[model samples]
Target: MKLSTRIALWAAAVVPVLVVLAGLLLLPLVGRDLRHQQDARLRDRAAAVLPSVRALVAADTRGRPKVEQNQQRKVVDAALDSGVRVTAEDGTVLLSVGPQPADDRAFPTAPGGPATVRDRGAAWRVLTARVSGTGANGGSGTLWVSEPGGLAGDQTAAVRRRVLLVAAVSAPVSALIGFALAERATAPLRRLSRRAAELDPAAPPTPGTGDGPGGGTNGGTEGGTDVGPGGAPFAAVRSGTAEVDELAAALALLLSRYDEQALRTAQALETARSFSSAASHELRTPLMSLRTNLDVLAAHQDLPPAERAEIVAELRDDHTRLLELLTALGTLARGDLVEVDSFGPVDLAELADAAAADARRRHPGAEITVELPPELRVFGWEPGLRIMLVNLLVNAAVHGRGGPLRADPARVTLRLAPAGPVALLTVDDAGPGVPPGERETVFHRFHRRRDSPGSGLGLTLVAQQAALHRGTVRITEPPTGTGCRVEVHLPLPDAGAPTLRLPARRDWITGGQRGDRRP
Candidate 1:
């Protein structure tokens, strides 16, 4: 059921019950009030007839029949509707008037306020007053005045009937008022629902830092507006009502999260496609070479030992190439799909040191030098940064050797330091440098020199890691003037810095160098 309808039904069910309960509480008080008024009336009647009662007692005691009769008439007149009975001090009844029990024995003997006295099946409020005449004809006696007890009961019954009528009438009236108010209150929520329902999740989110959708850097919609498909605004309703405002804010946040997830999902799908395409195209040559070598070994079982050894070496080279290509592609895909939550504080100098140590072990003939600080930390993905450092060192060791006229051992220098808000790292090589015209193209996937023995993805991995960390990478001339230097600048961690915002466009493996641009 709708919220308004539920509220209305609850009001209808509860209001009448509350009214009935209030009536139950008031019933006793009403009855008591009525009884008090009845008692007051009986007291007044007893006072009015007291003098006449005294005269009647005196006349009867003196044996004057005419006087006694006249006083009896006066007593009856004063008593009105209430019952009265007069008794002489000598224990003889002087007069009895209005409603009364046949025997006066049931009357209250004490002279005080009115009290209930029952005779046979009837009840009465009786007040007793002691009267005495003045002067020569002075006499004493008791005067009893009472009204029917049912008077207060009848009044209380009428009040109960009226209360029941009110309770019955309030149910529907209260329900209708409650429904109307509830409907008015929920109008904003209904509008919010309609606007939310109109949103399209597949539409690309407005870029937070670009001129996309919501207009430059305002994050798609300004103020409290959310733009849906076709640029229609899903206005964040902020009625003065706290509940409605809170709900609207929650809805806006939910939509923002949905857009973020949708973008991430699209990126993941693109990465998958690129991974498949690159693997298929790049693995074919090595696989063919491996197959050809295997066929030669199978067909030439009686070939010379030297020739057989050459064939086996060729197969091993092909196998190594295949393995390196696959590993590079997998790492590229991981960088594309990485989330910011995986990033944390990493010591770049430590990673560079480790990479240099591994490079020394692998390329014992190469002369490697490292100039790194004790610690140079940055906020980044540790595995990715380590991969980047490893690739840089390996690339330098493999390609840093000179042409025929150069020295026997290759030379590579790794350095790390801080530059303002960024951590600067450089790898200098003493080999033939890349031409200036080709420096930009060298970072592209599968782009390598023809004579190079390594996978071309080494520099590409370096570039990808740079972009993922919101950093930059560029190739420049080394200080020696005869070789190349690759410089990577990564942002340093700061206590008051805002969270990193990764680039919205990530197409590393899919053939676009957009992600490598210096931000």
Candidate 2:
């Protein structure tokens, strides 16, 4: 149902029930109040006739029955104005007045105190008192007074009837008023809905200058236009209520996010299509060269010994280089698809130590040194961290050419430390430093210096890993002014006394070392 109709129906159903409950709760008190008023009247009448009753008893003690009867008659006469009935002891009827009793119920024996009784059959109220005295004929007697209960009943009935009448009549009337108010309240939301329904996502947004129908761009559109990225526009409709306004704002925010994501998805698809085409084209040349060389070598089984050895060595080296290049390209592609959930906490010190050990083992002639704080930790993906470190170390091993050139030993250093609220990892190599303008370009995929013999994805992987960790990587001259330095700064883990957990194994395809388990 519509909100206004629901509100009206709810008010109609609930208000009458509340009215009836209120009446029910008040009825008993109303009845008691009526009885209290009757009791008060009885008390007053008993007080007035006390003296007359005493006088009648005194005469009876003096043995003058006729005088006593006359006194009783006088007492009854005086009480008649007040609606009283006086009865003597010994079951003698002295005087009876006011409304007659419906039966011989003996006026409900007052016990010389005040009391009230209801006569439902006669629909009357009665109060009685026991008359007492200290004279010879005065042990106990009764005085009774009665009035119609119809007065109180009528008053209560009038109140109840008025309450019910108000409830019945005002229910629909108030409900109609409520419905009108609700309709007014929801009018803005209704307008917003209608305007939103009219929007067309497929249509090109109206141009800036026009005088055509449907508000013709500049004049006034069916709804307000909110500009999004790439100059596209979306409808922005608003409801005036605070809650509805907030909801509209939230919806606008979500729609903008959706537009941004759609654009990103389109861009990613285009980039992927281009990369696939280029990769396929690039791989064919290397494959054909390797196959032709292998076929030529196979066909020359009787060639000179030295020529055969040289050709076999060249083929093996070419095969290795080709495999490395293909592997690097595959790694770069995988990095492009990395998502946020691939990140977690990683220990930089442990990653540096492992990278140092691997570099020493892989290149026995290169000197590797690692300087790391024992507990340097950051929030990052373990595989990405390993990839970054391994690439840095491998680049140093491949390019730091200092052993025979100037009698200075080539050295690679991996250092990690806590820099303020961030973990800083720096890899320095005693090699000819990268040129100032080429520092940033070294991180681009397939962009290699003329002297480097390896696939150019090493620094690209480093940059990608840093980005995935929400960190930054920069290449600069080393502090000693002799070598290239690459530094990565990652945000530090949350501050607390650290808890130790088992470290996870890193992925091999992402440049992580495999098969070294820690228990």
Using lDDT as the measure, the top candidate is 1
lDDT of each: 0.81, 0.66
Backbone atom clashes (below 3 Å) for every candidate: 1, 0
Model 2 clashing residue pairs (backbone): none
lDDT of 2 by residue, 368-428 (tens): 9888888777776787688888999999877775644634555888888888887888888
Each candidate: RMSD? 4.7, 10.4
Worst 10 residues of 2 by lDDT: 210-219
Worst 10 residues of 1 by lDDT: 211-220
Which residue segments of model 1 deviate by more than 4 Å?
Answer: 44-86, 90-106, 119-122, 135-137, 199-266, 289-315, 401-409, 432-438, 479-482, 498-506, 515-519
Candidate 1 lDDT over 349-455, as tens digits, reads: 88888989999998999999999999988999999999999998888887788767645467999999999999999999988888988888889888889988877
Error of 2 at 409 (Å): 8.2
